[model samples]
Target: MADLFDNINDWLMQEALDENPLTSIVETFGRRLVEGGVPVARISIGRSILHPTIGLLDVQWEQDTGQVNTQAVPRQIVRNSLEIFDTPFGELSKGKTDRLFADLRDPDEVARFPMFEQLAARGMTYYAAFSRSFGRTHHLYERISNEFRGASLSFTTKRFSGFSQADLDGLERVLPAFCICLRMDIERFVAGEILETYLGKISGKQVLDGQVERGDGQEIDCAILYSDLRGSVTLSQTLDSTAYLDTVNAYFDCVATAIDEHGGEVLKFIGDGVLAIFPFDEANRPRANMCAAALSSAQEAFARAEHANRGRSGDGLPALHFGVGLHVGTVIYGNVGTARRLDFTATGPAVGLASRCEGMTRELDTPLVATGAFAEHCPRAGADLGQHRLRGFADPIALVSYPLT
Candidate 1:
């Protein structure tokens, strides 16, 4: 048993440096315990995570199938659920107990927790749960308590005699090392989630792939879509701060959702405006496909805003009005800004032109406008609004308007 634990510790140390995913680590650890004669039928590990959408991460490994399953509990669900307090893991996390052991075969002991009864019904005879702290807490810790403070590990067995003293002692001795490995992987995961949240998916991956230096970028041809909310200044002046923020978020949800669904990346939100792109890849995504996707996204954004406006009107709130512009051109996409504060985004004349096209929507009294470069790709031609000299550009550019149906 001592030698088995030593091997597990050595493997865990290497894994800490390798930073493999937490799921794979937990699955292998459970298998190792079973091979060492621990008779573990199931192992579950739960820990709080710092994510915009997810509050908790749960990983379960079952010896019967030698498979691991993972679940990401949403922040709202975790906040409202009282069921956590009824489990042994909940008791350990609350600091009411450091460890829990139950003889599942004993009716009285099985009745101690709802989980014990479930495990006994599944033919498990004994169960043990342990808590390990990562020694760090954040704002979420105040709301969820010890749940956000660290991790909880539970092991269940079908063995008639349950886990012996030696098995429990071995686990107690090895748990710290295992937790250290898990923390390493978790930190990496959190970093990625934050980056992806702040930066678009493509840009975030580039940063993670070691493209962190300022001015590190690549020139690429893509279709750019820019949309701005109309009368935002007046809305801001009339509405309170909270109400104005909610309104802006609602507008963003409409535009961003449409862009994402049409295979575009929302690069940034500049006040009331959104800048997004659908890259043109000759191998995977053709130029026409990207341009069409950008146009479709603009149409969908208008449709979503119209639906939202109907609800707002019923509630005696102002309707939402927005304009979208589409253009296709080459732009530099990558990191920019100060050494300390970098922003991953797209920049160039094409991006400027796309914004200008959106600005033209107000003058033309249209909801959607596209440059000739973008309109050329559409199967159905748009009504040409004639060549007009746009601001910042000396040459007159041809523009077209699409009918949002």
Candidate 2:
């Protein structure tokens, strides 16, 4: 048993060095333990994560199927529920216990947790849970206790005799090494989630691929979509801070959802405005496809706003309104900013033109406006609004109102 544990530890170290994915690591670890005569029937690992939408990441492996399954618990549920504290893993995580061991066959022990009852029903005889701290504080887990900064791992066995002293000892000895590998993979996963949450997916990948230098960027032709909430300044002055923020978020949800659904990436939110792009790909997606996608996204945004307005009006709140500008041109996409604080975004004359077109929304009294460059690729009929002088450009640019009304 001691030799088996030593071999497992060595294998974990190599897996950590290779940066193996957490799912694959957990699956293999469960199999190895079973093969080493530990008789582990099920293994579960749960970690608190930093993310906009997800609060907990759980990975479970079953010996029967030799497969691993992962689940992302929503932040809202994690914040609001007390169920997490009711389990054995929760006790270990809160530092109330160093480890847990229970015989599912014992009615008294099975009564301790609802999970034990289910495990017994599934033919699991014994259960054990242990926690490994990541050696750092997590804001989300602070309320649960600052000590719960890492992962909770649990193992169950279906053996009639349950886990013997040797099995428990071997598992305990190898756990630390396995957890070290898990931490490495979890940190990598968190970094990706955070970067993708703040920056668009494309930009996040670029940064991960080592596009860190300040001037590292490339000019790419794409369709730019700019959308801004109307009367935001007046709304800010009239509404309370919380109400104003809620309104802004609602508007953003509408715009961002539409853009994402139409294969566009929202780059940033400038106050009450959104900047997004649909990059043209010669192989899979062409320029016309990108332009059409941008146009469809703009129309979808307006539809979503209208739907939201119905609920707002029913509640006696003012209806929401916003404008979108669509254009296609080349822009530099990459890292830009001060030496220490950098932003991954798109910038160039094309971006400026898109913003200017959005500004024309107010003048033209239209919800959606497109530059001639964008209109050319869109098959949908649009009402030509002839040449109009924009703020930045020296010459007047032609604009069109989409949907032909």
Candidate number with greatest lDDT:
2
lDDT of 1 by residue, 1-405 (tens): 548888888898888888887778888999999988789999988887777888888889999999999998898877777886577766776766678888999999999988888899999998888887775666664435543477888889998999999888888777888888878877888888888778877777889999999999999999999999999999999999988898999899999999999889999999999999998888898888888888888888889989999999998788888999989899999989999999899999999999999999999999899998888876657999999889999999999999986
RMSD of each: 1.7, 2.1
Candidate 2: minimum summed lDDT over ten consecutive residues — where? 138-147
What's the true lDDT of residue 220 in model 2?
A: 92
Runs in model 1 deviating more than 4 A are: 139-143, 146-148
Local error of candidate 2 at residue 91 (angstroms): 2.4
Candidate 2 overall Cα lDDT vs. reference? Answer: 0.88
TM-score of each: 0.96, 0.94
lDDT of 2 by residue, 195-299 (tens): 888897888889989999999999998999999999999999999999899999999989999999998999999999999999989897788888888888888
lDDT per model vs. reference: 0.87, 0.88
258, model 1: CA deviation in Å?
1.0
